[model samples]
Target: MKQIILYAIFVIFFTWNPAFGFLSGPIAGRTGAPDDICGTKSCNDPPVCHGSYNINSGPASFFITAPSSYVLGETIDVTVSFSNTGSGLHGFQLTALDASNKRVGIFQSKDNTVQTEAYLNEYAAHTTVGTARTSWTVQWTAPLANVTYPVIFYAAGNQADGEGTPEDDYIYNTAAVIIQPTSTPTPAVTDGECDAETIQLSQNLLELQKGESREIVITVKEENDCVAGGVSIKATIKKGKKRISLFPESGTTDEIGQIAFTITAKKKTGKATVVFNADGIKSKLKVTITSK
Candidate 1:
């Protein structure tokens, strides 16, 4: 009887009303591994976390339009959109990186380049596609144009990809643009850009009594290991220098967008702030641990 009850609870908890990108990847396979990552085993069907491909044969499409060239100090706008053509819901984030995959510019939020409208869609029964419509627009003073830049659309890599889940999934694309000054030099943007994408932080936070420790799966794209962009990621806790709590063994931009990390809350802790920053954006979340 106890085992039966426990199994029932597990079923209910493990199977939430999941209906989004997390469910849109490749076919079924118990492996849970994703394809196209740096180097890791691949799942049978790849448990969704589908990479630049789709499993449910979902209809997914995306595009971006921007000026081929701009003058220095001129505000540049980029528009991007995608449609999920299957029952599986979809979400995406965008990021502009230099040729080196190093994140570019300053956005308001430090989280993934999450979509503002909760990047979700619904797939009808017996249907292979759902649709999501959105455009990414941002203005920036032109940079050196001749230096080709890469615009990347970030879909959460396989949870094995790097860090964070679909809720925290950040999808972005990279492209190159040129800057031409109109006979006048523009001042450098030293204070950082004022653009920010608000991401719903991971929903798990716990309280640990003295000596009680909990390991958390921290998903952060900037902390990802396998992808090519080599995004310089740094972390801090309690406003001072702190050792990184969690990390992935290897790889980047897998089918699932996740970088697994562990965090342990020790004694003398009541409430603490775990702050993460990357690509000029910052996300600060609260973690509380009560004393016994």
Candidate 2:
């Protein structure tokens, strides 16, 4: 009779222990699934661990970090972190989806603590429940084709106390949105008219007090002095990126072959240089900021 009791206790202990049991299968897309539990069935299935434990109602303890914008076909780093440092073991599932709720990016990671889900290549989850970690980073490659909608990264993290049961454990879910780069309009070509040869700035030097702003105009022209409209132009701060701000950093020339930029001086009193590129043609502007 004692042997039977011990066997039953052992079975119950392992059954509720997340480290040794539970979540035996892949856990992709389960972050936003209808059911809060992990690994009982597909993301579309109903809740199976209803009486096990109640979902935590406190502030989110998990967060995702990703770039605000993504270029087509580019690979960017996305990281998931847990705020609860006291947890002994951690597990997570993450996936990126488009506005339509369809998976949109591929995830890759070198960390042994995490792996891509076997059922869905897009979902990345913890490799094992036994590994104790606070954060995981994965490289996500944006789709090659243009996805007009924003890409949202969903992540769910489990903070376990490693106490051999689901009691006191918490699950947190969060998401981040990444926008697509603005599209540049194509230029209309007329016999040598679109050949950009020079970039002219309205002001080569700007002097401003702290917290002041000034506007400058850029013009693109061809060898024959013809205005080159629809020319893609990019503005970069060569120095003192933190001391000054440039607005409309990148844009296309209007029909008059002109584009405008607004430069604002920050609290710092320093000099900065802004470089402008218009279809290979380059120009530089100097800016000096003084204390008010």
lDDT tens digits, residue span 111-228, model 1: 2333222312110000112112233343344444432222221221121122323222222221222222343332222222211222112322333334433332223332212221
Each candidate structure's TM-score, on Cα atoms with residue i matched to residue i, is: 0.30, 0.49
lDDT of 2 by residue, 20-122 (tens): 4644323344564222233223222113222232232333466788887777778888988887467566777777766444578788865676677473568
User: Model 2 TM-score?
Assistant: 0.49
Total clashing pairs for each candidate: 62, 0
Judge candidate 2 at residue 261 and give its lDDT.
82
Q: Give the per-residue Cα lDDT of candidate 1 at 118.
A: 32
Q: What is the Cα-based lDDT of residue 226 in candidate 1?
A: 20
